[model samples]
Target: MPKLTKYQRRITWSTGIGFILERMDAMFMSLALASIIITLHISKAQGGLLPAITAIGSIFGGIGFGALADRYGRVKTLCWTIIIYAIGTAGMGLTNSFWMLCLFRIIIGVGNSGEYGIAITMLSEAFSKKYLGRLSAAAGVCGQVGSIVASLLSAFILPRFGWHVLFFIGIIPVVLAWFIRFHLPESKEFTENRDAIEKDPNRDFSHWTELFATPAECFLTIRIMIMFMIHIAGYNGLISWLPSIAQERMNISVAGSSLWMIATIIGMSLGIMCFGIVQDHLGSRLAYGIWLLAAAASVFLLIIAQNKLEFLIGGGIVGFCSDGMYSGYGTIVSKLYPTEIRATANNTIMSIAKSVGSFSTVLIGFLMDHFSLMAVILFLSGIYLVSFVIMLSIKELKHENKAPVTTTENAEKVAQ
Candidate 1:
């Protein structure tokens, strides 16, 4: 197997733990839904509010944590997010009311959402320019492993010990956070930036808004933001609704539905693994464009799929195309910005995209109630086509030996 350097391995494992724990919490929610409803005597609508509200909260968490990771340090801010995530998740186990679960999930959303940008930024900074794409993809692929683990863990824990114990398990990632703080070396770029900031505390490091200070910067930021929005909306809609879609389409029991999730998970993991290398071989826009197009085509197959075998195959292809492009986002955002606000750029945009895009769940639900599941899936396919068109508009920053997008002025130097 291809291996990372020692530094990359440490980063991979640390970030990977966050990914696993986060996905486990998410997957556990589906299994625990019945228990939660019965315990709290809440309506299905009220129960659904919890996840939606949590996603909204994560948008703020991402921006706030991204800024902190920029001004303070990536690892330190990341540790705080872990604490937040653990608290949010574990507290849910103790909730006696629906509102309390909503509150804790909001907290969890912030932490989980914030975790992605900071971890990706750190990995991008730690690796050399040459290794950036694959390592980041590896991190994303690790996240899908988290999903797969969640499915397995949910299958094991939910029936035996019940739901609360599963949430208490959320506390486990705190150990990983501790390891990151004590053992992992801070990124060299972050260390340099911290020193520079201390010497000149007056220097403004917040570049989330300043990203549009120039034409090239504005163009790049807007293009990627639009592209990521479509990606998140389409991907989240599919994953959230897929089990039901599969259960209905395939006429399977809840236990049997794991096959659908597993197939999708495998496809997603493979897609990211493939996209990571493809991004390096092809340039930024083309790599994304290809996958976005494939994603649309895959969804078309999913809607038309007639039998269990066809749907399973279509699910795998959709998962591969839809989620795999996530790795490319890290690659695109990493090269498009400099170290000073790199973390902020990655987190804020992604968080915003996710927050907005997550509404696809509600949208799909509405459409399904009125139209049909096939109609909703067809809508998703059209969204992917839109994403592909948006990808074409992006003017990529050339991956050069020079520090990529270090400053507004420097951004122009690498502009293609």
Candidate 2:
């Protein structure tokens, strides 16, 4: 591989840092939720509603930010999101009332909504298509590192300093925004479309409408969206219950659960990197299908494992297969849309999928309360099968740049 140019290097650094910060903000809440509920004297039902509120805010925020990025610029939108999330995170520490905490979570969600979409689109546009999968996977890996960092901090800090301190630590990401402003350049694709943007400065970019206007586009978008929903639902649903499951099933401590989660995250990071390389070689469609099936089987294995070592191994494999395909989704979305509408299209589909997954957390938790772990795992595996079928239905969008005549000639030659 050739050495990265100054611009490409800057893109990688900014994206990796930005994604890490955003992911820390995203996963911190889940890791600290039990602590937060105990500290605030809230019930599990109320605690569950907080994430739902955040998801609701994210749905609207994603569409709004997507339009804003298309109209104004990606960097400006990202800067504002970082600032907003920082304030919300700090405020989450200060709020004593349940409703007030939920409100703050909504504020955080608004910032979190567009963070992934803009970063993925900007980085994808910055790098060459040949390197897009690797770079996208690298970002996913960075996000997992952030999750690991948050988990480590929660393990060390939450017991002594309390959950409030965790929110206070979120100030780091807010400060990182200034660095992003100085270091990250506007995407080349966005820059090239400046003239068109200038001509319609006030136009409303309804990404949902644009994406669903045609049958083929709608089919592809829905397939990706369903896959994302299943991935998030399965991964987050299991992880959210992991500590409780460990305590109930194996008589483990909170700290021990955190250690298990760390192991799972390590597997996630490795899987992200490996998936990128595999998708590039194997094609996204096939890579996604195989991984989804593996994830389903892993989830089932996780529920039945009686020994701690087997349980942890199953958890790691579940993490690897479930979260591994995330990078491919970004790469596929980038390839699916043209430059003009890429950010909006990517954000709209992904945000709704994320929202669905987030909302399902409560439902999953409720089911777990009533049913066995094995039953929940089986239900989640069924959802993964839905995603797998959807993924296989979509036509592969990679390698679209090759000449159509060349493909036709090759087909004719093969026939001879």
Candidate 3:
């Protein structure tokens, strides 16, 4: 009900821009893969490996830039990340050789990899605990917007202008870096920490050590890491398989398949919005449990749907239940750590989780080999169940001075 402060306003806008740009370029690779395989004269295997390479680049980028953001500065490092993302994206368009394409994709991966942890760290620090989840959802919703626009544009652009031109369009976010560099203020927490550092010139500020210096912090850190791993694994497994499942089961063409994706993304938007508001009201544990349980139930809905119309409707609900909980993590993760290493904590967990989650491809493949596709998908739902159980042990980290809290103290405070 209250107006967002100046800091919250800037972070939401800037991070939203970064997500839009970063995700659009990432989505472009998906749309361009077909044309790229043909133009580069590559094997089917190579086409599949392209995105994997980009992901690998992201792991390194996240660690490298995450630390830099802590050591150097958030705003300055963010501009650098944008520049790298833009250059990598544009270079992908200009390249003629297959290796060059791989190179540029890695570059793009490296650049975009740093976006989430750093930007979300900025957002988490800028706002109060009350608005953190909603703001986090808003940032992700911006990414969804970018993905939708990219989907639409790629449909229009690739057929008319070719895949290379699509990559050129990805570079448009480079302009955003200019605005961020000039207009965005450093996070207040980081700014004050910097001043403190200046006043005491010899103090050590190594985040990796501080993260484990205390048992409670270490326990919380590990718990969140495991939770992310399971959450992402289940999400990636189901969503990645949905296209093929829809195309085969519905017997639809590529364009028709887009309907399923669009439906799911719409669901994702609604789910994100719902989860944020609910979590802020209900506290993280209860909110996550309900959403994850709903996600599992929604997955079974996929099995019962007999037609495209039913499938589309189910897809929306599934998207909502499955990913809505994601809105909580930005607030939750940052809350567990201090400003001294907040970016470090977020990026570290994100990088590791994404890398581990990629194994969902292998998991699905392994499962389908042993069982039916429907059965495998249904089994994947149990992942959320497992995550929910783990979450029970992950208590909320409440601090004084109005820092974000991850758990509740009493039943009456459920909606506090």
Against the unseen true structure, what C-alpha lDDT does each candidate score?
0.75, 0.76, 0.72
Q: Which stretches of candidate 3 lie over 4 Å from their true place?
A: 5-7, 31-48, 94-102, 160-162, 362-371, 397-416
Candidate ranking (TM-score, best to worst) = 2, 1, 3
For candidate 2, the per-residue lDDT at 280 reads 75
Q: Tell me each candidate's TM-score.
A: 0.90, 0.91, 0.86
RMSD to native for every prediction? 3.1, 5.2, 5.4
Model 2 C-alpha lDDT per residue in residues 1-416, reported as the tens digit of each score: 57888887777776777778766865677777777777788765566667767777788888888878877788888787877787788898887788888889888888788877877888878877767788899988988888888888878887778778888997886687547567466877787676655677553333556776656666767777888877767766766667667766887666677777888888888889999997777778667878888877778777678899988888788788878887777788777676767778777877888788876667776776677777778888899888888776776544533321112222345688
Off by over 4 Å in 1: 1-5, 30-48, 159-162, 200-202, 397-403, 406-416
Pairs in clash, predicted candidate 3: 396-406, 396-407
Better of 1 and 2 by TM-score: 2
- Per model, state how many residue pairs clash: 0, 0, 2
Q: Encode model 1's per-residue lDDT on 97-151: one tens digit a residue.
A: 7778888988888878767778888888877766777777887877788778767
